[model samples]
Structure formats: structure tokens, C-alpha cells
Target: MNSANLNIRTDKDVKEQAEQIFAELGLNMTIAINLFLRTAIRKRGIPFDLLLDAPNETTIAAMEEGKRLLNDPAAPKFSDMEDLKAALDS
Candidate 1:
């Protein structure tokens, strides 16, 4: 396959940081970029699947609070949609 050179300008600090990391793994910037581009082309998108981790502390705390409210034994239970709507409308 014929390959052409690609040049791009990026943030110096970010590039330096990435360079350091890749260097540690024995990859230079050019090789890393070529590998990434090849992978993306082969996959027809970004090479890796992205997985979202659970949200940060505030979000987790709010979710826990919601769970506690939903599971509270003393909390009034809604028997049906009408009851739930009535509870919400009050």
C-alpha cells in the first residue's frame, strides 16, 4: 500500500506527555500515529471500544440516596400508576 506523510499541529504539553509515555513503551510519535491510523482504517472507526466508568463521587452519592428512598420500608408504596401520579402531583 502507498503511504503519504501526515503532519499535524497539537498542544506541546499534551504531545510531550504522550511522547514520554510512548517512548517508555518503545514507540515513537510517528509509529504511534501510523499504528493508530491503520487500526482506525481497518476497524472503520476508532480502534478501541470505549467503556464509561461509574460517575464521580457526587453522582454516586445522589444515586445511593435515590436507592435508599426507593427501598425505604417506612416510605409510602404506590399500588398503581394512578397512586404514583397522585403522589407526584401532591
Candidate 2:
């Protein structure tokens, strides 16, 4: 079978980190890349979910509220489950 050389450019740190992971998994970079290419070809796209791992607007607002509560001295602090239940029931 005839093969062609593929040249890919990436950040040095990223390449080093990936190389370390692949090595730990008992695969060299070439084998790992070929496996990815084969899987992509079989699936007609990337074989994994690629997503931006950022919080949504609602989640961001909730996190900000949590931080505000954490910093506020007057925020209610429940010492036990009963206290929490009482606070909730009131």
C-alpha cells in the first residue's frame, strides 16, 4: 500500500503533552494519529463530542449569586439539617 506523508503544525507544549499521554497509553504519536484518522473516516466526522466547556448565562448568574452569598456576612448559615428545614419552612 502506498502512503503519503502528512505534516501537522501544533503548539510545542500541546504536542509534548499529547505525546506523554499517548506514550502512557502505549501508543506512539503516529499510531495515535492514524487511529484517529481511521475512526474519523469510519464515522464521517470526529469520533467524539467537541464542546466549549463554558457555563451558560443562567449558570454564570447562579455562580455569581453563590459567590455573592459566600462573601456576604448577613447570609443565613444553617448549622444543621433541622435548622435548614426550619428556614425553608418559614
Which candidate leads in lDDT? 2
Candidate 2, after superposition: displacement of residue 78 in Å?
Answer: 30
Report model 2's TM-score to 2 decimal places.
0.61
Give candidate 2 regions above 4 Å deviation: 54-90
Number of the top TM-score candidate: 2
Clashes of 1: 0
Q: Whole-model Cα lDDT per candidate?
A: 0.93, 0.97
Candidate 2's error at 58, in angstroms? 8.4
Per-residue C-alpha lDDT of model 1 across residues 13-58, encoded as one tens digit per residue: 9999999999999999999999999899999999998888869999
Report how far residue 39 has shifted in candidate 1, in Å. Answer: 0.6
The collision pairs in model 1 are none
Angstrom error at residue 81, model 2: 37
